[model samples]
Target: MTDFLNILLRFFHFSSLLLLTGCLTYLMLLTPAGYRNRLEIRLSPALRSSAGVALFSAIALFALQTVMMSGEITALSQPDIWSAVAGTRFGHAWLPEMLLAAVSFMLLRAGGEAARYLLLVTLILQLILTAMTGHAAMHDGWRGVAGEVSQSLHVLAAAFWCGGLYPLLLLMQQGQRDPQDNTAVLTMMKFSRYGHWAVALVILSGVSNTLLISGIPRHFSFWLTGVLVKSVLVAGMVMLALLNRYWLVPRFRQSPAESRRRFIRLTQAEMGLALGAIAVVSLFATLSPG
Candidate 1:
């Protein structure tokens, strides 16, 4: 029960955090100034909801971890137990995570470019804190430092790729409604131009994280199987992205409506695949590397 709850909460936390980071990154970097204001207004509610989910999940996960560590259901009411857990490495990370999530949620209420930039900082910092407690924490010294950095890059790249899809989907939908809106094409082109780099970084950082955490697994373990599945899912996402960029996207001028529909459908598929990969990671993260 505890294990299942842990994985479930992790999925929710990661999904929300990734979406928050990805949305903001896309708006600030890939989105054109003409469309940025409108999209920001549209996505503000979602951003706040993501922050709220992240904050709640972080607290729940921390409480669950305390129970797991102390092996007592009553640990929830124990101040000493809470303090002890807070002093540990995971606690150290969670403290910052909680603070960041709270600040992010509050900041989302304010208007202007400054708050958005601050929110982005908080999201990225939370990602780094998250990286510190996972498999990377298993190692010590410089190797551990390398692992966390690589993992941070992996997640950051993924946030840009996986999280940016929502805004892109919205843009495309807008384009479909009013064929004259060129922002969709401009944003899509920008995403494609820079998205290739994000995808490349995700693959490279993933491999680096694997190598740093542990050399190639010689035995068939749960961890190995999970990694393989995640790789295949990511590969599928890449192929779909390429098809959209090279094939469907080109037909936009020749057949705008048909192409837009196809693009949206495929984008939805990519999102499904991305969430599946995240779920797999959340599940496997609970397993022992060895």
Candidate 2:
């Protein structure tokens, strides 16, 4: 039951973080100024929702982690639970993330450029804090610091790749409504360029994290299996992205409608793979990194 609760909380925490990071990344970097107003209207509700979820998930993770450490569900009522939470590594790392999540929730409703940027900064900090308590931080000294940095970069890059998908799909929907407008294609081209960099970073940081956390092992384990699954899913996402960037996106000029259709379909597939990867990550969090 504890394991179940842990996995559930991790899923929510991971999903919420990804949503917060991806949405903000898309709005700030990929969104075209001309389409910003319309996309903002569509994205605001999602941003607000994700922020709320992030806050709730952070609180729940804190409570559950406290309970896990105490090894008693009734620890919810113990003073030592609070004390442990206040003093432990995980608890110390989580407090600021909870505060940031609350601030981000409120800021998402502000609906201004500055507010959005601030929200992004808050989310970035929350992601970094998350890295500080995970398997990356289990190491000691400079190696631990390097692990944390690599893990943080991996999270951010994953958010850019996975979280940006929904917004991109929305933009494609807009393109469908007005097939004449090339803004969607242009924005996608820009996003694709950024995505290449993000994917590269994800790979580099992921490799670093894998080596740091588990190293080159002679035997298979559940955590290693999760990592392999995540890698395969990510590879699939990258392949689909390449197909869109090299083949389908170019067809937008000659076959706008068909290309848009194909792009949306491929994007949906990519999102599926991303969600699968996130599930693997959540499971990995629960498993011993042997």
Q: Which of the numbered candidates is closest to the native, going by highest lDDT?
A: 1
| Tens-digit per-residue lDDT, 1-290, candidate 1 | 89999999999999999999999998988888777999998887888789889999998999998899998889999999999999999998998888888898888787888888888999999888899989976799999889988999999989999999999999999999999999989998998898999999999998888778768767878887888899999999999999999999989999999999999999999999999999999999999877
Tens digits of per-residue lDDT for model 2 on 1-290?
A: 87887777778788878977987788787777677888888987887777888899898888888788888879888988878887888878998988998898888878678888898999989989989888988999988999999999999888888898888898898898898777777777778888899999999999999899878877899888888899999999999999988999778879888988999999999999988888888889878887
Which stretches of model 1 miss by more than 4 angstroms?
none
For residue 284, give model 1's deviation from the true position in Å.
Answer: 0.5
Model 2, C-alpha of 18: deviation from truth (Å)? 1.3
Quality of model 2 by C-alpha lDDT: 0.86
What are the lDDT scores of the predictions, listed in order?
A: 0.91, 0.86
lDDT of 1 at 187: 90
* Per-model TM values vs. the true structure: 0.98, 0.96
